[model samples]
Target: MNIYKIFLLISLLFNTLVLQAKEEKISIQLDWLHQFQFAGYYIAKEKGYFKEENLDVIIKEFDFDVDLVNGVLNSKASYAVGKSSLIIDRLEGKKVVLLAAIYQNSPMVLISLNNSNIKKIKDLKDKKVMLTPDARSAAAINSMIISQGLNLKDINFQQHSFKLEDLISGKTDAMGCYLSNEPYILDSKNIEFKIHNPSEYGFEFYGGLFFTSQEELRQNPIRVRKMHRAVLKGWKYAFENIDETVKIIYEKYNTQNKSLEALKYEAKILKELAQFEEGNLGNIDYKKVEEIKRLYLLLGLSDSAINFKLEDIIYNPKKINLTQEEKKYIRNYQINLISNSNFPPFTIETDNKLSGIEIDYWNLVRKKLNLISAIEVINNNQEANEKINTNANNLKYAFGTADYENINSNMSMSVDKVKLALTTLVDKPYTTAITELANKKIAITKYASYYKDLKKKYPKINFVETASINESFDLLQENKVYGILGKLPALSYNITKKTISNAKISGIYNENYELRLHVNKENRVLLNILNKAISTITDEERKLIRDKYNSIIYEPEKDYSWVYKIITFLSVLIIIVVINNRKLNKEIKKRKLAEEELNKIAHIDGLTNAFSRRKIESILELELNREKRYNRGLSLIFFDVDNFKLINDQLGHSTGDNVLEKISSLVNNTMRKTDSFGRWGGEEFIIILPETNKVQAKNIAYLLKEKIANFDFEIDRKVTCSFGVSQFEETDCADSLLTRADNAMYYVKRNGKNEVKVV
Candidate 1:
C-alpha cells in the first residue's frame, strides 16, 4: 500500500473516534441498592434507548454514606432519583429541577407483624420503630404520623437493620419499608405482616423523582429533554414486558442478590405504583407537587409562608413539537405585549413592571415554548390598540381586548373565562337571582362590554357608571349603590383581601366572556404556538395561579380567654353536681335508657355498624316483592376481601376484624341512600341497589371497588375486593338472584381479585 492509502485509512479512523467522543457522557445516581426500582434506567442502558439519543449513560448504585442529591448538585452525576424531599431541598436553596415522577404513589410505608400490635399509625406511638436513614427525609411518612397527632419523640426510634429477619424475629415493633420490597419478601416466606402507607390517610407522595440541577437544565435543555423521553420510554417498555425486564434485572443488574421471583414481584408492585396503566409514563403532576409543598410547609420541614412557585421546580415537558421554521421564528421573534394594567388580579402594573395572572400565564407559555424574546410591557391598552392598529405586524400580542371583532383579529386560546357577578353588602336581601336587582341602583364599569346589553335587559334598574371595577366596588361598599356589577375574580379578590369585608357576591350575570391573548392575524405561527402552550397548562396549575393572586390570608383571632374561663368554670360546676350524686335517680334512669337504646340497635352489625345479616336478608326479600309489584329494576352487589383468610391467619383475628370494619365503613359511606348494605359473613358484604339495572349496578360496583382498592386498611395492607352484580329478573327468586351474583363474584375471584363482574 502507498503512504496516501495509509493516510486515508487513519483519517477514517480519526473521524470515527471524533464521532464516538461526541456522545455526551452523563451519570445518574440511584437512591438505593440495585433493584427493580431502577429498572427504567437499567433498561434504557441495555436497550440502547440512551444510546439512541447519543448519550453515554452511567448508572450509579446508591451509597450508604454519600448524599444522592449532593452528588448531582456537585456535578458528580448529571441526574438522580430523589424522593419528595427534593421539594424541601429546593425550598432550602438547593437548585433541583424535578424532571419526571416515575412513581405516582410512593412505596414508603411503616410495616410490622400481626403480633406487634402496631396496626395503625397511632399504635406506633410508644413502640420500638426502626427507620432507615432516608426516612427522615420522607415527608409523607412524617406527615402521616404528625397528622395523627403523634410526635416522633413518642416512639423509641432505632436505626434500620435492613433485614427482614429483624422484623420477623421481633427486633423492632415497626419499621419504615418500601411497599414494593419488604412485603414481597414476607409473602415469599409465608410470613404475615401489615403496612401503614401514608397515602391511606391522605399523605400521598410521588416516589422515584427523576431530577437534575437547574444549571444542567439551563445549559443543556435538548440533552435534558432527550434523557427524559428515553427514561420514560424505558419504563413503558419495562412494564409492558415485565417478565423480560425481570430476567434482565436478575441476570445483570440485581446487585441486591434478589431471586428472579422476588424481582418479578417487585416489578409487578412497582408497575402498579408507577400507574403504568394510566399511560403518560413519568408524567409529573403539578397538583401533586403543590400538595407535597403544602405538607412540607405545614410540617415546618421547610421555610414557612414562602411563595414557592411550583413551576420553578417542575420541568415543563415540551408540549408542542415545533417545526424547524416555527422553531426558527420562536428563536428570532420578540413578544410586544400590550397588557391592561387596569384589570386587577388579571393584570397589575407597579413600578413600571407588569404582574398578575395573565402576565404569569404568558411567562409560562413563553418558557414552555422556549421563546427568545421577553414580554415587552407597553404603557396602556389604548397605546397597545393604537400600536396594533397602526403596526399590526410589529405588535404581536395584546391583552384586555375584546374577542375577535375584525378580519385582521386572531387570538390564542383564553387563559381564563371572565365570569360576572353582582356584589352587595352581606346584609342585603339579594340572592343569585338577577330579578332581585330589578329597580335597584347598580354600579358597573363603563368599559364593560355587557353594559349596554344589561341596561337594555333590566330597564327598571338604575345604572351608575364608574371608570373602573374598584370604583364600582367602592360605591357598593359605601352604600351609594345597592350592588356592583364586576368580574368574579376581582370581586372575590377584594372580598378576600378585606378591602370590602361586608360585601358578598349575590348574583352572577348570565353573559360570560373569554379572556384571551389576542395575537396579530399576521402571526399565525405565534397563535398556534400560544394555543399549544395554553393547552398544556393543567387545570391544577391554573387554579394554583389563581389562588396565588387571590389567596385569603386570615387575620389572627382576638384572644377569648375570658369567655373560655367562664365556660370552664360552668363545666366544672356541672361536673361536681353530677359526681356528688345530686342526680342519682336521673343517672340510673339514663343508664336503663342507654341499655334499651343498645338493644334497639340489635339490627345493626356489632362491628361494622352496618345492617345485620338477618335484617339485610329481610330487606332484600321485601325489595324483591316490591320489584315484582312495581316492575322497577333492582340489583345486588356481592363482594368480599381477596386475601381475608390470610390476613386473619397472619395478622391475627383482631387485625382482620379491624380490616373488616374499615371495609364496611368505606362501602357504607360510598353507597347511595336508597341502597341497603350489610355484613353477610366473615370478610363478606352485600349491597342491595333498588331501582337499578345491571349496567348502573356494575358502575356502582366498580366505584366501590375503586374506593376499596384505594383505601388503606389496618396497617396499610392493600385490601382489594372482587365484586359481583346481578339485576333482579322477573322469574328470579331470592336465592336465584343471590346465586347469580355469587357466581359472578366467584368468576372475578377465579380470574383476578379487585375486579368487577356482572351477570
Candidate 2:
C-alpha cells in the first residue's frame, strides 16, 4: 500500500474508537433516601431508557447534611429532585437554577389509618400526630391546620423517627408520609389509610423539581436539554408502561417487597401530578410561583428576600419567545398584590367599617388629596412587608407612623431611638433590665432589623426569632419575653383596643422619628403621588384623623390585688365551665350568629351597603357547588372600587370605607334580581350570575362597575368600580374558582379599575 493510504486508514480507525468510547454520563441526586417515590428514576436506569438516549445516568440518594444543588454545582451531579422552594432559596443564595418540577404538587401529606377514624381536618384537634425530623411536611401540615382556623397548640405533635412503624404500632395516631411512597406501601399491604393532601387544604407547594447549577446550564446547554428531555421521556415511559417499569425498578434496586400493583398505581398518580401544560412537562407556572412565595411568607420560611417579577422566576426552555403585545404588556405592567384587606382602624372587621385612628387618618388623606387607589389596611408589620414586597402591580403601600429604619437604607441614631420606642410598645415591656437580649429568652422574627440590633446590643438576652409580627406578638402574649422593640406608628397602631392591655410603651426612647409611608421601589410614581398628597394635607387635618382613629392611647395600670383576685376567680370559673361543657355550644352559637350578621352586614357593605368578602364566599360557595352538582352554567363577576387603596392611603380607612360603602350601595341597587352578589375580599366584590356564561357575566360585571362609577354618591366626591368576570370551570373548586375571579378583577385593576376583564 502507498504511504498516504496507510495514514488515512490509521486516522479513520482512531476517530471510530473515540466515538465508540464516548458514552454520555448524567447524575441525579434524589431529595431523600431510596424509596418507591423515586422508583421511576430507578426503573428508567434499569430499563435502558437512558441507554437508548446514549446516556449513562447515576442516581445519588441524599442523606442528612448533603446539599444536592451544591453537588450539582460541584459537578458531582447534573440534576436533582428537590423542592422548588429550595431551588428558589438556592437561587436567592446564588446557588442554582431550577429546570423543571418533577411533581406539580407536593407529595407530603398527613396519613392516618382508616381505623384511627380521623375523618376531617377538625378531627385532628388535640390528637397526637407524629412529625419527622426537619420535615417540610410538618410545616405544610401545620399551615394546613392554621388555615382551617386551628392553632398549632390545638394538636399534640410528637417527633418520630422517619418510620411508619410508629403509626402502625399505635404509638402515634397519625404520621406524616409522602403520598407517593408510604401510601403505596400501605395499599400494597392492603392496609386501608386516610390521607389528607395539603394542597387541598391550602398548603400548596411544588415538590420534586429538577434543578442544576447556573454554570452547568451555561457551560453545557445541550447536556441540560438532553437530560431534561430524557428524564421526561423516562417519566412518560414509566407511567405508560408501569408493569415493565416495575420490573426494571425491581431489577435495579433489588427490591421484591413493593408489588407491581402498588408501583403501577404510584406511577399513574405521579404522571398525572407531573403534568404542567406550559413550556414542558416540568415547567412552573409563575403565578403558582407567586402563590408558593406567599405560602413561604405565611410559613415564615424567609423574609421576603428579593421582590421577583413573574418573568424573573418563570423558565422557558424555548427562551424569550414573546409577541409584541405580550412584550408591551409585561414591560409596562406592575406586580399584582396577592390579596387585599383593610389596614385600619386596626384591621377592618368583616363589617368593612373603620374603627381606629390610622383608618381615620388614611381616610382624610384620600379625601383631601382627591386620589383614587385600592388600599388594603393590613393589621400588622409583617403582613405589610409581605404585601409590599409581593404586590405585582406594586400598588400596595404601607402607611403608618413608620420608622426611619423601615424606609431608610441605613440606621441613624435617631432611627435607632425611634425603633427603640416602637419596640418598647410592641415588645414585652423590658426594663433597662438587660444589656444583652440573648439572656432574656426573647423570641423575635428572624428578619426583623430591630430584633437583630437588640440581639447585637444585648446578646445575653435569649432572643427567640419567629417569622412575622403576628407570631412575635403571639409569643409576647404568651409571656415568652420581657417585650419587643418596633417602630412607633406600627406599635401604636397595633396596641390600640386589642388584647394585651397590660402592655404599654415603657418609654419613648426616640421621639425624632416621624412616621412615613414605605412605598415599594417599583411604585415610585405612586409614592410620588402620595408624597404630593401628604405635602398638601395640613398638620391639623392629619391630627384630626389620627385623633379620631388612634385616640385611645393604652396605659398600663398599677396591679391591684383585689382586681387580680376577682379577674382570677372569673377566669377559673370560665375555665371550669368550658372544660365541663366541652361542647362550646355558646361559642359556636355566637360564631354562627356572628357569621349570619356578618353575611347581612356584608350584603349592605358597611360603607356603601354593598356586598363583602364574607358574603361573597358564602354565596359563591353555594352557587358554585350547585353549579357543579347540577352541571349548570354559572359565572363570577368581580368588581372593585377604583383607586380604592389610594383612597385608603390618601384619605384614611374611614374615608375608604365611605367610598366602598357608596360604591357597594350603588352596585346593590344596580344589580338585577337574578344576580347574586357579595364582597370578594378587600376592595373587590363579586356577583355570581347563575345560568349565565362568560359573555353574559362580562356584560353584567362591566355594567355594574359602570353604574357604580357613574352614580352620584353625594358623599363629597365621585368614585368608580373596576370589573373582572369568569365562567366557572368544570374542574373548579371553591378556592380555585375564587382565585380565577380574583385574577380577572386584578386584570381590570391593572388595565384601569373602571373597565372589565373576561377570562
Candidate 3:
C-alpha cells in the first residue's frame, strides 16, 4: 500500500473526529435527588435524540442547597426541572419561564386508613393530619382546605418525619404520601387505605415543571425548541419501553438505591401521574395553569394581583421525524377527522361552513399529507367516542379529553390534550372548589371521568344537568343557575361569541386530561401514520392554530363567507360617489360652485374621504338609540395606525395623512349601513356594529386585517393597526361603551401591536 494513501485515510479520520466535536454543548440541571422522575432526560441522552439534533447535552444532578433556579439564572445549566415551587417563583416575578409540564397530575395525596373517621376533608378536623414540610403535599393539603372555605386552623396539623411507621401503627390519623411512594408499601403489606386527592376536590396542580430563564429562551429559542423536542421524544420512548426505562432508572440513574420492583412501581405511577397512558405527554395545560395562579392567590402564595401571564411559561413543541411508510400512508389515504360544531378556537361552524384552529391545523396536514379529507361533526362526546370505540373500522378518529373517559381504551388512543373549565357569572360569581358549592345551583351537560368521585363526595350541590352544552349556557344566562360548567376552547369560544356575558372562570377541571388524536386501535398503519403527522407539526404551525383562532384574525385573501354582499355594496357606493363627484366637479368647473365643495367637505373626511367625524357620530347616536329600543347586542371596535407618529416624523405629514386615507378607503368598503366606519380622532378609527355581539364584531376586525397589512404603500411603507373590541351592556352609555373599546385597544398596544383584543 502507498504511504500517501495511508496518510490520506488518517487525515479523513481526524477530520471526522473534529466535525463531531463541533456539536453545540449544553447542560440540564435537575432539582431534588436523582430518581425516575428525571428519567426522560436520561433516556433522551442515551437514545441519541440530542445527537440527532446536533446537540451535546450534559446532565447535572442536583443536591439540596443547589438552588435549581439559580443554576439557570447564573448559567450553571442551560435548563432545569423543578416542582410547584417554580410556580411560586414565577408568580413572585422570577425571571424563569416554564418550558413543559413533566407531571400533568400532581402525585400528592392524603393517605389514611379506611378505619379512621376521616373520609372527607371536613372530617379531618380535630384529627391528626400529616404535613410533609419539604414536599408540595403540604401545600396541596392546605390548598384543598382553603378551596373548600376552610383554613389550616381548622385541621390538627402534624409535622411528618417522612416515616411510614407512625401512620401504619395508627398513631397518626393520616399521612401525606406520594401515590407512588409509601402507598406502594401499604399495598404490598395489604393495608387497606382510603386516599384523598386534593385535585379531585379542585386543587388540581402541575407537579414537575421544566424551566429556563426568559433571556435564555429568547436568546436561544432554536436551542430551546430543539431541546424541547428531543426531551418530549425521549418521554415517548421511555413510556413505550417501560421495562427498559425502569432498568435504566434502577441501574444507571438511581441514586436512592431503589430496588427493581420499587423502580418499576415508581415508573408505573409516574406514567399515571403524567397521564402518559392517555397520551400527548410533556405539554403544559394552559387552563390548569390559570387555576394554579388562582389557587396560589387563594393559598397566599401570591398577592392579590398576579403579575405573570400563562404565556410566560407555555411553549410550542417542535416537529419530530417521520418514516417513509407513514409518509406514504398519509399521501395515499382519504382521512376523516372527528369534530364538533360550535367548538371555537378548535372547531368552528359558521354559516354552514367550517373554520377555526382545528380546520387550519388539519388543512395544513391535508396539504402536507396530500390526502382527501372529510369532517365528521359529532356534537356529543359520548356518541363520538362510541362510534370510534364500537365501530372503529368505519369511524377512524376524533378529539377528546381524558377526563371524558368517553373513548373506550380498547379501541382509542389519546394523541393530544386540552383544559376544561367552568364558566360563572362574574357579577354573581360562585366558588369553584367542589365542597364549597354545597347548595348552589350549577349547570353541566355530561360529567367527565373526574366528576364521578366529585359527585359522590359533594352530593348536596344542586347540579342542573342539561341535555347539551348550549343549554347549559342558556341556564346560566336565564339566572337558573349560578354558574355554567364546560371546557376550552369551547368555553372560550362561547365567551368570545358573547353568548355568555359577565362570565369568568370560577372553576377549572380535569386532572391529567388531554386533547387526544384518538385513532382506531385495529388500524395500526393509520395510527402510526397520524401519530407521526401530529408529532411533526412544527411550533410555528401550532402557534398559527392555537393563537390564530383565539383572535379570529385571517389574512385578506382568505375569504370565509360565500356572499359577496360586502363587495357589491362597496362597489355601488364607490360608483355613486365617483359619478356624483365627477358631475359635481364639472358643475364646479363651469360655475365655480364653492358651495357644493363646501357641502362635500362638511360630510366627508378631507384627508381619508371616509365619513367625517360629525357624520359618523350622528350614525353612532342613532344606532345606540335603536339598540336600546330593541334590547339587542351592539359592539364597537377602536383601532389606530400602529406607528403613525413615527411615519409622520420620518416622512412628511402628507405621507402620514395619505396612510389614514388609504386605510379608510379599504375599511369603508367592507362596511354595511348597519355598521359605521369613521375616523374617531387623528390616527384612530372607530367601527360601530348594530345587532352585533363581541364575537361577530371580532369576525369583522379579523377580515379587515390582511387588507390593511398588504396595502401597497409607496413610501414610509409599514401599515399595521391595534384593535380593541367591546359589546354593549344594558346599563352602558355611548361613553362607557367607547371607554371599554379604548381600554381593550390600549391593552393590545401595551402588549403587542397589530392584534385584536376583546373586553
lDDT of each prediction vs. the true structure? 0.78, 0.60, 0.70
lDDT of 2: 0.60
Model 3: residues >4 Å from true position, as ranges?
1-27, 31-33, 54-62, 113-118, 122-140, 153-175, 304-306, 318-759
| Candidate 2 lDDT tens digits, 581-697 | 777787889899999987676465565455566666777788887898887578877666777777788778888776667666665654555676676568766777776667546
Candidate 3, residue 258: how far the Cα is off, in Å: 2.9
| Best model number under TM-score | 1
lDDT (10s digit) by residue, model 3, range 466-554: 76677888888788998765654666667767744466666555533435456555767665545445655676676666665443211
The TM-score ranking, best first, is: 1, 2, 3
Candidate 2 segments exceeding 4 Å error: 17-21, 33-36, 47-49, 52-54, 91-94, 114-134, 137-142, 146-162, 184-193, 254-256, 276-280, 307-315, 320-639, 642-759
RMSD of 3: 28.0
RMSD of every prediction: 26.9, 34.4, 28.0
